[model samples]
Target: MKHTIKATWMRGGTSKCWVFERSELDVPGFTTDEVLLRLFGSPDPRQIDGVGGGSSTTSKAVILGPSDEPGIDVEYTFAQVGIDQAVVDWGSNCGNCSAVIAPYALKRGWVEPEDGILTVRIRNTNTGQILIERMNLDGSEAEAFIPGVPFPGQAVDIGFLDPAGATTGALFPDGKELSTLSVEDEDPRTRSDITATLIDAGAPVVIIDAQTAGLGTADFRQWPTACTAEMPRLERIRRAGAVAMGLAKTEEDAQRAIPKLAIVAPAESGSDADIKVMMLSMGAPHPALAITGSVALTLGAHHPGTLIAQQLASAPDGELRLQTPAGLITTWQRQIDGQLAVGTSRTARELADATLSFDPAGERTENPAVILAQGTGLDEQQLEPDPPPHGRRTVFASVAAFAVLGLGATLVGGGLLNPPATTADGDYAGETLEVVIPLAEGGGTDTWARFVGQELVHDIPGEPGFAPINDAGGEGITGSNRFASSAADDGTELLVSTATTVVPWVLDRHVVKYSFEDLEPVLVNGTGGVIYARTAAGVKSTRDLIDRKKPLVFGGISATGLDLTTLVAFDLLEADITATFGFEGRGPVNLALQRGEVDIDYSTTSSYHSAVEPIAKEGSATVLMSFGQLDEHGEVVRDPNFPDAPTVVEVYKDLHGKEPSGPKLEAYKTLLGLTYTYQKGLWAPKDAPEEAVDLLRDSAHELSGDEEFNKKAAEVLGGYPIVADENLSQRVKDAYTVTDETKGYVTALLKDSYGIELD
Candidate 1:
């Protein structure tokens, strides 16, 4: 007899799965398994007669129902149906599929919607875990785009509370932060033991260092190929880990569905993510990360001595961003009472709803046809009139039909029934915007790029989302040149320029292949700086600084970079100061000042607040002068943001008993204007269309007026005004201009004092 079941296919995060309302499936325990296996066409390598998508990621199912438990809306059981095996492993919950539960419930009327945010509590029957979903009911599509997913939809915030022991009842199943697993090898010369972290949060996970597995590269793109080649060794290690975690009584009983393995390495320099990870699902590399695995990995990152924890030792608090093959995934964890609460945002959309029908008698049929509504079934030629007993051709035909029908249904349901139309303005309507930050992650430039990119998501016309790509190398020259030479002029590509980039171009450095003149500025961000001295130097004020006998040591970078202004300021003041160059950035220089390695140092206003304010409060450092902001008349004036600190000009006049003037003063003002007043800005290729430039400028102007943005700017940019619209053009022109007299004076000063020649 033929039996039919209603099912909904949905895309959750990067994976797609078949979802079923549990109460509707009347089949009993073992019978239900048999029915689902037949429906999925499992046990055959190709699952030719079933609805499986062939790959492990697509061949998954969820059975959800209204939960009777208090405060819980739904209870869902996640099943991983093997493609080549007639086995349904309920060993773990699928994080990606779990994301669909709340949405499915809302659609099914299992949960009532509220006026604002709807909260849904879910019980994962497989792992006996609770997942809370907070959804915005504004009916607006999610604007945040994740990597790998082609479309954007509604965003759902999922929280896995106390997930540390969801599956195994213990944070570390082995009762140790780090466990050593013994591996039998063909070669005795190599290491026989591997160190791993065996923890059970959303799922049982095995964490190990990529270097230990001989995967030395931190590049995520190379991981899949490397994993495919070393599967046997990796599987052996996984089995050993399973034994260590006590999840398997013997290696033979170890299931590939449980205890997922993840190889991790420290993120490359300038990367926006704290760590780089590659996850393995069902014996193959996952193209994107698993939400369940992310939860487990997040907990491991917080646990001390674990491999993941050690790599994230310096990670910022509150949000932990990880780099995956698909892009950046941010996760947050907080301890409530004694249990750890983990949260992440995921996007899900329902694709189609249909009743699936198949004859149980034809379970072994090689070429079985699936019946769907709306004539969305396989072609007659693809379905055999007489079922074949067994053959590769039948398998091929069945799999092809499944894919074609599935895709057709999705396209028809998703409003992609027709070809996409272009916008009249030729703006970036459907294109993915890439914002390039030519600095290592966690630097000032990266921070600014991410902030601006986030704000641009809402302000830009067509509401195109922005992806910040950190191409840190060659001291900012590599990314700058790549953007100039390769980026298209369709307003989809933008470069975030900082003083690191400006200085290279201004000095005519050999490493710089791109010209500032070849770029068009859209928004210029102004930052202020303060030069201070360590209290140990005994120079409490500008007067004390002049009278001090000791020559103050200034820790700085290359003089041709941001430090050029500080160096020129030192010469103008006639203070006995010697600069020790080659510090990586302002961060290191600030550290040096605290350690007394440098008696005097300057930090941008933002850094001054976070890193230096404490030193000053502790009486370890004293502020001497602020670089200040330019007035309407283009004269250095006291910064309204830091009213207490006097301008460099004020400090100079007080120290020298005369107004500061000369070619040196002109050069100092020129470089200072370039470095502080227009330190960072947004730019596009010089040849970009005029419409694109205007759109970006208008978007930035709108963003600058946003109350939330202005509040954040006060905290990060020291309340400095964002130069946009009419002011932006003049700002760019001023920053790019250096008079011959001023240039000559700066060039001569560098050659004479620092024994360095300018190009």
Candidate 2:
């Protein structure tokens, strides 16, 4: 008679394992080990009777159960079953297997799923540590992908918090950074002392220098063949170090598994990894990295005076990239609220879900021939079988379950399903919107994009949410062109534009492939600018600027960008100013002024408040003039935002004794109108459907009026007003329209003054 048990075969990171729910198994406490041993066909060199893959990586198991611990959702125990012995070691946890527990729990309804990134807390019974898994979930689909995994699947980020003492209750289990172990030589009378670092981070690991280990190359692939002759010597060192670390009573008692051995050396030039590491699992070379080993290496890299720290070139910036036999794996480590948090990416895939039948009365089928045929490579046929009845549920069932749980179906069968009309008040009820920002993260444009995206989630109809993707490069040309060429016109994709994008387009830059005219404006963001001067240049007020002797060196970005207005202001005031162009952005230009690299610079209100305000208050810098805002009659007027500062027009009149009017002033007005009055805008393809455009316009209008949005916007946007509806379209037209005379004058000025020619 056969006893059937439910099981899930999965590939976690680079390793494969079988996952089982604890309650489903009928075996008792100590006897459970015997059943698993027989089920995996262990205790024989080539156990063909069961499902062991004949290698340590392929021979692993995880038992999952609902956790009774506070704040932990599930408890998972990782077992390392021996390939050639009836032994099950539950001494340590598998980081790769730990990544899958959360997803499995979510699928089994062990934890409730939330929109956006979902956090699942799990307790690893083996190491007695808690792990947090953060995953991006869009219904049943996940977003991230691990770089080194061979297969295609969603990658989950698992963070081990305060992992320094996960295993042995101390970072250095043996309470020493360096330890010397004496190993017997082949001559039987000779002995050599090897230096190793025995530390417990994600796992207990013994780290040794590759050169001292007599390993010819640091390349892990070569180590398997090159270190074959010295395997016994290395194992002896591991055993000795294990006893010293108190993991074993004697060298013979050490299973040669738990404190895995690692050979390290300096990374080769042109490699992405900071260092090269080769890990051995169960006396064999690991083709790729173990996630826990990566955590251990990360901790060691940060720790002072360890072998890994000595070999490393410098301290890593949050993430540590290590080279392995397979490829590079990056791990990030940081202290959050005094806890050491280590995070790494791992991809999990459900290979097969079925019932495995076993017999206690039947003959043991331990065929070495079958085990040899299986080899060491991943056997997809054996690991993945046809989905069982319980596993092959229909999409309708999932949708019904979501509805009952009060979570609408944002995605069904990987396709977006339109929500009901009442939910969205339109057709785009259950859609996921993406807002593309053409700047790097932490910049003003990215901040604006995030703010708008968050507000849109609240204002847009239905259960729609917006996510921002920063595709920053080519000084904003890359992301703008990407959106123009590839973004879908179904109202799902929107572009976050800044002066960096509009300036290139207006200047006819060769790299600017996108046309502002080809896009439709849905919203316009208006921000004011202030021209400031370094106090060391002897300019405190607008009057002092005209009396200055030395030519004020103005730091600017590009001649055709927003700096055009500042350049024209210099001409209008008849000020002795020399323009130095090619700064990345206003932030860099301000830094140049602060460092005394330049005498004068202009910054948008947002940057001026955050960065320049402190310098101004310290008497290092002085505000000279504000660009101000244009009135309805197209006259430069005092900006309501900066009521204390005089307008640039007022400053020019005060200095030159006349109202500013010329080709320079016209060009300045055109550039100012384009850059300052409507510095940032939300746009979509010109041919976007009228209904979608109206929906977006309405959403923006609602967002602008929202009190919560206004409060947040004041902090992020420097109190800029969000211009929407017809006013937004009119602003775009006014900014883009320029007279032939003004354009010719600006083009010539760019060439003669700044040595820049418009294409």
Provide the overall lDDT of each model, using Cα atoms, as 2-decimal numbers: 0.74, 0.72
TM-score of 2: 0.48
- Please report, as a residue range, the 10-residue window in candidate 1 with the lowest summed lDDT: 384-393
Stretches off by above 4 angstroms in model 2 are 1-427
Cα lDDT of model 1 by residue, 217-335, tens digit: 42355464345435557777888888888889976678766789999888878888999898886665665688888988988887777889887748548677988765789988875
Residue 545 accuracy (lDDT) in model 2 = 73
Model 1 residue 725 lDDT? 74
Considering only N, C-alpha and C atoms within 3 Å, which residue pairs clash in candidate 2? none
- TM-score (all chains, Cα) for each model: 0.48, 0.48
Candidate 2 per-residue lDDT, tens place, 1-759, comes to 567778988888767888889866564322455556667776443346777775566788999988888988888989886553344666667887777787788788888767666678888886678888877777454744554453466668888888886667888887888777877676769988888888888878889988877764433434533454455577788888788878899888886467788888888777778988888766555656777777888888887778988888888889988887656788998664576789787878888897876555432334322232223232222222112111222222223223323444476798647534332246455555667876655567776777677677667666463446666554676667767877877777788888778876776665576888888888888789888999988888878776566788998766665677788778778788888765656776777788789999887887777877899999999988899887667778877768999998888888888888878777777777788888888887888777887888888888888888899788777787787865777767877887889767777877777666554
